[model samples]
Each structure stands twice: as structure tokens, then as C-alpha cells.
Target: MAYESSVPYRAGTEGYTSFRIPAVVRARSGHLLAFAEGRVSSAADSGTIDLVLKRSADAGRTWGPLQVVARNGTGTAGNPAPVVLDSGRVLLLQVRNAADATEDRIRRGHVPPADGRRIWLQHSDDDGASWSPPREITGQAKLPHWRWYATGPGHALQLRHGPYAGRLLVPANHSTPPTDPQDSGAEPRYNGGHALLSDDDGATWRIGYTDSDSDTDTGRSVAPNETTAAELPDGSVYLNARNEAAAAWQRVDAVSTDGGEHLVRPFRPQAGLSGPAVQGSALHLGDRGALLFSGPAHPSARALMTLRTSRDGGLTWRTAHTVGGLPAAYSDLVRLDRDTVGLLYETGDFSAYSTITFRRIPVEEPT
Candidate 1:
């Protein structure tokens, strides 16, 4: 199936040296909002970064001018996790850190609390036209022992069916302190997947389903990072995360039966799903009774953007459609309507960070 694509955010174009971490959502106003990290200096993870966005009023055909949703001056503000509430208000969760505070320093607990990674919340009442000032929610969303933290870097989920319906859930990841005092906490093994929940709309937040086991030697332990989630057909929540373990596959997964409060199944390598160690997105097709995943299909490198489908609630997956064969990285999925889906991703000829494109694909083409 052919796809209609457009470059919403191109590196070096919007006063940003690079644009990374693509996230998109359809607001209650029926407008598509595409977001990314506007890196001011370089494509590196650290430095002055702004949470930027663009809106497409006519599906994914075209995008509006760039808008800075949140900025921290010389500090870093990125990892956008956006969701539209039932009230038509759009809530966005993101993180911030000092300009010089790199992930290594933050993970190793070398930075002070003020300069360390912190979570923040922002809301848009006029769709993508304007946004409220960022309000810190780090204490409620982050654990004291967690050093490195990040929100979805993609679109978050909201429950539609069951008693927990209307609850806002955000898939997230964090790094715990090292078990061994002599060991540095910079190891990816210390990373784990988690979720943040808000019951009273986006007014308050709390941590949920933390997979921070201190023992890395245990075969059951998994280093799940950069997570994405979807609500299954049976009202359960399925989480698919980027596995950081060197010996395991690039993907790990779990399930939460009690809304987003706890995980019934802990993080484990998802068999048959092959890809590089990078972030991916998951979506549940309620009408079709199937689940969809989008990410790179290459086993060793971030390339070949592919879409997979699982009919049995994420137990297994099969290649459904290959979107493109280019250098691809992080991606997010949005349901445009009953027949079409939208994908916001990073892809380029030479590097994935060169452009963040939005692609419209037929829903039936992937199922």
C-alpha cells in the first residue's frame, strides 16, 4: 500500500540544528498535532532542547508553523508524551535537565536534585495554538531512587472501557540506583520500564508499575526502556518497551490487568518481534480486535520502518507493512479514522534525525 507523507519537522530548518523524538496526537478539535525535540546546538541528547510542535488541520496533508510548547532556556526540555483528555483539553508530560547535565552524570547520581532530570506537565486549551506554562510534577511521577527519567517520547494512552475508563496513563522509563556501591549507575541494566497514572484528569499524577529489580543476574529481570503502551480488547493494558540488555532481543513486554496500577506480568523479552534497540509505538485497534506496532524491522540497525500486527492481543506478531527502507529511529502511531492511521517518525537518507516525517497509511493495509 502506498503512503501519503510530508516532512513536518526538518533538521536545521526551524532554528534547530536537529529534531528528534517524534510524537503525534489528534486533539478533540480534530486537529493533528506533531511534536519533536528542537535541539538548538547538536543532535546529541544533552544541551539546549525545546519541546516544539506543529499542527495539521487537514489530517496529515500539511503542517502549520513551528511553535515552542515548552522551553527552559539553556536547560534541556524534551521527551514529549501528549494525550487528549475527554474534556477536550490536551495534556503533555515532559522532562527537563540542566544544559550540562548529561545522561551519564544524571544516571550516576553526580548531579544535584535541582539539576537532575525532572518531570513537568503542560496543557493546551486552544489545541496546538497556545500552551500553558510548564508545572513541575517530578515528586509525584518520579521515585526518589530513580536517577534517569523520561516520559513516553510518544503519545500516551487513555482508558476507554472498564471501571478505570477515562484514566490517563503515560508509559515511561527510569534508571534505579546501582545495587553495588562500587558499581556506577550508568549501566543500562539499571534501567526499567514504568508508567504514570492520573485519575482526576491531568490535575494530579502518580507512579505505577515500576520494574526496578536490584538483581540484574536474575533471568527474569529485563532492562526495559523507552516504553509504549496500548489498552487491549479485554480492558487490560499491554506494554511494549525497548530492551536495553545486550544478550536479549531488542523488545520486552508486560501486561497490567488493574488499569495502570500494577503489572500482572513483569518485563520479559517479546519473542518473534525483531528490531534494533530503539523506541517503538503500539496501538490497539478496538474495532478490528487487533494490535498494531510500528518500528524499524532491521535486526541490527535502525532501518526499514515496518508495521506489525497481532490479532491475539500482542502474544505474537507478523510483518504487515513496510513503511520505508531508510535510516529510521523513534516513532509514534495515531489513529486518524476508521480507515487511515498516521505515523510520526524520524527518518533520513543519511541519518534519522535529519527529518521527522508524518505518513498516512490505510488501516486495512496493516491488518
Candidate 2:
């Protein structure tokens, strides 16, 4: 099915500058809000990276003005995952890079302060119109002593029709060590990749999966990139990850049936089209178990920023269609109704951070 693309979303100067790493969700009130890392100015202070937002009132038919949600210089106001809590409030779990402003640690692998790039949450009482002050997920405020840096890719979801009904599960990306031996420590090699779960919405978190003890044993840290998740029919939570070992292109899977309590093994590679640079969102579309992914559809080279659909979970995929003609990075998708799908991606030259593009994608049944 060839879905026609519409130019409903675009980046603005203030909050939409060179937008990259996008996350979108249809709020409880049928409102669609797309969030991205907004680059405001070109100056050093401009280097301050923040999470900007755009709202779509008419089912993604169009978008509203841009607004800033979170910011930290060159340090990235990374990806955000929105989950309408059991209490009807919308809570966003996001990553913030505090040390991104320092010129000294640009490329030298300056170990991010303990809490270098940390996870925080912003709650909205009025359907994203106004948000409360950002609060760090974990209250341990010693900063550098926090030890963990860069934790996110959080997709908070509630268990539907399951034993754990109301409990909120936040599958977030984190840099940590593994617990089980059978599990692969592929993350440590690449410095990170793991998921953390929070029972009390975004208040407290527990490690779902991580690397093994020995560094040499763990080949690559499978950083779960801009990944979205879904609960399988059997009550297992399947997390789609962009393993750094696979160059962030290949999609990895983590399964936890008892909610997000503990993940079994690390992950295995699927045979579809992930390459050197791929970041995506995986959605369980319909009855055929259709899994739709939005990411850099770089089959060989990072060229096509596209959307691909698979009849089976992640086994096989049909030829994808590009959302925007240019380079598309860190794309996200939401199910408007069963048939309609809304997509948001960072468009423009990812190499130089030129511009961010957002759009409305209408999915249709293949003829």
C-alpha cells in the first residue's frame, strides 16, 4: 500500500532548529505532540540543546508552533517517550545531557559526569499546553557521583488486559552491567545499551537488562536507540533496540513477559534492513501482527529515511517508502486509529544539523 505523504509538519527557528531524534504520541485527548532536540542558535550558548515540541490538533493533519520543553547546551535534550499515566496525566520520560556545553570534553570520551546524561520527567496537566518543572527521575543529586550517563529511549506503557493491569512499565535505555550469565554483555564493549523499568510510573527505576561482568566477554553495548515498544499477546514486553555493535542500524529485541521486571537474554539480530546508522520506532499495527518501523532505511548506505512494514514481528519486511526525500534521522510513529498512522522525523542534513522536518503519514491497505 503506497501511503501518500503530506507536508503537515516542519521545523521552526526557535524550538525546531536542526531537530533530530524525534518522539511522538497521541495524547489522551486525541492531541498529537511531537518532540525533538531543538538547536536554537549557532553561538556557544546556542549550543545549548533542548527538547522542542509541536502539537497536532487535527489528527496530524497539521502542527502548531514550536515550544521548548527541556534544554542543556551542546549536551543533548535527547529523545522523549510520552505515556498517559493510569491517573489520566501525561508524563514524559526523557534524556538530558548536562555536560554537552563544555568545550574540553568534546571528543576525548570525557566520561560523562556520573549523572552526566540523566533521565528526567515533565508532567502536563493541560494536555501538554503547560508542563511542570522538570525533575530528575532519581533524586540522588550528587551529580558526578551518579556514575551513570546517557540513560533514555524510554517508552512508558501500561499492561493491557494482563495480571499487572495498572502498573506502569518504563522500558528505558541505560549504560550498565548485566546480571545473568546466559545473557550477552554485548553492550559494555561499545560502552552501553540496556533497559530499565519503573514500577511507579517514572519515579523509581530498576535495571531490566545490562552487560556481563567482564569487558572482553561483552562484545558491544546494545544502546537501545530511539526505540518504541509494545506488549505481545503473551504478556511479554518486546523492546526494539538499535545495537551500537550493529552500528545502530540493526534492530535488536528484548523480551520480558512479567511486565518490565526482568529481561531474559540480551538480544539477537533480525534479518531485515538495519545498517551503519539506523534509529526507529516499532509499532504492532493490526491483526496480521503487522510491525511497522520508522528509521533510516539505509539498505546499504544511509540514504533512505523510510517506513517499513513486516507481516511478522521483525522477521521479514517489504520494500520501504521514504517519508522525506532528504536524510531522515530518528523517526517515530503513532497509531491514530487502526488504519491511520502519524510519523515524525528529524529531516535535513544530519551531518551538519541543518534542519528538522516533521510530516503526517497516512497508512493504507495494500491493493
Estimate the TM-score for candidate 2.
0.79
- Please give the CA lDDT of all the candidate structures: 0.89, 0.59
Tens digits of per-residue lDDT, candidate 2, 1-367, equal 3443443334455544355556777788888777766655532322556777778788876678777777654466665777777666788877665544332231123444442556677889777888989887654311232233443343457666477666666555433433344533232333334455656766665655453222545554344543456766556666676665554336676666677666666565655756445556776655546667777766555556777887655657775556655665566677788667776655655541344445556665753
Encode model 1's per-residue lDDT on 66-169: one tens digit a residue: 99999998999999999998888999999999999999888888888899899999998888799998899998998888888999979998899888898899
Q: Give the Cα-based TM-score of candidate 1 against the true structure.
A: 0.97
Best by TM-score: 1
Best by lDDT: 1
RMSD of 1: 1.5
- Flag regions of model 2 displaced more than 4 Å: 1-12, 15-17, 42-46, 72-76, 99-115, 139-148, 151-155, 176-189, 211-215, 218-226, 246-249, 286-288, 320-325, 349-355, 364-367
